[model samples]
Target: MLSGIENAINSVFKPISDAVSGFVFAEVTVFGVTFPWIVAWLVVAAAAFTVYFGFVQFRAFRLATQIARGQFTRPDEPGEISHFQALSSALSGTVGLGNIAGVGVAVTIGGAGATFWMIICGLLGMCTKFVECTLGVKYREVHADGTVSGGPMHYLRRGIAERFPTAGGRTLGKVLAAGAAVMILFFGIAGGNMFQANQSFAQLRNVTGGDDGFLGGDGAALIFGIVLAVFVGLVIVGGIKSIGAVTSKLVPTMGIVYVVACLIVIGTNITSVPAAFGEILSGAFAPEGVAGGAIGALIVGFQRAAFSNEAGLGSAPIAHSAVRTKHPITEGYVALLEPFVDTVIVCTMTALTVIIAKTQFWTDAKATVAAGGPTPDGVTVTSESFASALPWFPYVLTVAVVLFAVSTIITWGYYGQKAWTYLFGKSMLSERLYHVVFCLFVVVGSVLTLGSVLDFADAVLFLLALFNIIGLYLLAPVVKREMTNYRRRRREGEVVRVK
Candidate 1:
């Protein structure tokens, strides 16, 4: 039965896969550079919002830290998880492959310049996170079972029903919520679950050479699937507190360790750092100008950064919405840190490592080409860079990538499950069914070609953002109202209230 099911999925997805390949080659280009459309637009648009919001990502920095530290958390808050855990769970999702593999891709294609753009995107993405998360908490519903089910869908429907009484207004809200839920399911399954598993297995296989039967090649993915299923099942079955407990510990420890490693590599080749920055600044606008004029250089840099940070994808809000706090704005402030950690900090480390590796070992020309090539083997490239800089770097990076990928897969599984339950209803049986299917796909992703599925998933994520941003714009006043209220209370030293 399992073999037959795999065959059926393969046959069904083949045509979709072919069609995506065709699209990637045909439509995505800027001066013969096959750039990713969804990523490109998302970066540009997110930058614009950051600008329009007066660079809130920058302004909100200190406050975000305060909220994360529990300094601002009151004793009488009403929510499922704390601010710290929300950040961790969300960070788990954002910080996984994009930090390791995605950064490698950026440095390869965009040269060091892509790192700069990624920072810009991440910085701007904080504002986007703030808006959606605020709305998520503001309009969330606590079911009789004491579980929370809220996101763009709840906010759109509740916010609209409350504010916009017109028939068309109500209809639009429902449509947008349904659309976001569906997109989340599609994106969560493909990009969040399968993609992570595929990359993790590929890297593990590359290193271990498939020596163990069930742990070899695709078998590694299967084993990974089962392990991941057990861990996630254990945590998610216990609800938010369990997920929060794991992330609270995992996120900070892993995050800080990865950053410190990159700093060592950067310090070793300190001189090249300036030249790397110079290259990034010039190539961001005119890649050809600095790297002898290859449009792919700019596209590669931008696409990798955008993919890693996910500033405008609207997926982060789902995780952020779960944060426990009375003030929605406080959580928004915390959400701002997403891009800083994911893109600016983590991605910077990867790029610096890559850049320094090139200076120390590879030729200028080869490094340049590797920087812009597709399938640049970022994980390997990063490991090579570290090994050159540090004695035991490969082992460390391999472990980091594995952990990062595993945590990421589990987080995405939850996201997809939420989307599934939102659309199909809160059936325990259906949730179990999705858990099994999602786990099974992890193994499949390890063995199969996912380029097409990745493209489709990315498109779905971007589509969610497109719809989500619309709702955000319409409900901007509500965000402002909450922000103002939070500030007023903070100034007055009143007990923080949910209202």
Candidate 2:
């Protein structure tokens, strides 16, 4: 009865969600597309942090590798999971549909140039990841019951309590924390779960053609819901350990498979590699390649890149916060690796596959589609490019996409569960119920027309970034202070011990 009611309520909100999305797009369009500006500002912020952090992401890269490799898996750390598990969990959240379909969208819309910008964003974003995640660990709180609950909220509240004794500071911290919690919840359901499931279904439907025929759309969603609900139940019930075990194995395997496939496609057309890059760099500035097409290439580029790495959107720290570490900056250093893996490496491979395939065989008619009409190929644009280079690629990509989508769903289930526990109390009942609900949505996400839902969810995610970045700025001094303390301990031959 409770689950039914929740589903009804979610259904009821559909119209409101559509209206909000319509309004948001309309408003965004009026300001001459603020997305470009949003992207630019985030790029600048990330860049500035990189400079200020003394290139810590670079300097600490080797140490991070060692940590991830289990060199520091001491049994006495004040956290729940290992460094590898934390990285896997975070990577699962990111290495999803965004890398697959998002890259295709970036290339189609932004021409080649968006790939260049995506790379830039990934490189600089490492610094932003380092700073924010360090704060997450530094200010994380241990509960009376010995459980850990942390993220921007704990840090925001504690940091404000200490640094700004004024009531205004307290109020602002509360407001930001509240806002971030809501955003995280919304993002968890919409982008993390629904968007992924929806795109997976869309791709499947396309691959199967209409022969597989969806149950009436609602019915189709219901079927998806039932299957995912069961699977999510099986994993999440075991909590972080189960989630970690699955993702640790899944993320790296799927990532390598996808990369290898892309390399195969790119190698087939190795001659076009230079031209593909040249086009990307040039197209980014002028967007000439997508100018005559229906959709603006520039819009495609930035949106895809933004969606892929989630740099400014600030959803990653929540996952990173779970790492078992005494030095907050250690997790931060690991966090920096996400965008590099997601955008610069994986996304770049997908983009290259598309461009190289396009250059070799696709016709002009296959290239152009006016703005209102569908793009010449749509999501399979990248796959088509691959198929052009390697005949068996479509099947290989199908497996890769399935792995990406499933791993993403499992990881995001934990994110939503955490947010649910935050909003409601951390009752066992609440945790179980949240998992059930989240899994059901996965099916709904798979079968539904979730394009608008994804957009709305993404918007909420940005709201999170807004709150987090503000808190990050406010607490910047604390982060620096901790770093100095860490460095001092190390330099003094104090042993700087951590379990």
After best superposition, candidate 2 residue 238: deviation in angstroms? 1.7
Top candidate, metric lDDT: 1
Candidate 2 on 1-499: residue-level lDDT in tens? Answer: 5456546656766676677555433333434444444555566677777887787778877766776765654667777777788888888888877787777766765566667777766787877777777887787766575556677776777777779989998898888877878888888887877777766665565556444556434365567567766876798787777888888898999888888888888887888888988877776676245542212454565456666777755566767777777778778767778777887898888888887788432334235532434554444677777778677777778777777877777777777776778779788789878877787787767655555456677666665667777787778777777778767766896534343
Candidate 2 residue-wise lDDT at 328: 82
lDDT of each: 0.72, 0.71
lDDT of 1 by residue, 212-254 (tens): 6435733555676666556656766666667778878888888
Candidate no. 2 TM-score? 0.87
lDDT of 2: 0.71
Worst 10 residues of 1 by lDDT: 287-296
lDDT for residue 32 in candidate 2, whole number 0-100: 49
Assess every candidate by TM-score.
0.87, 0.87
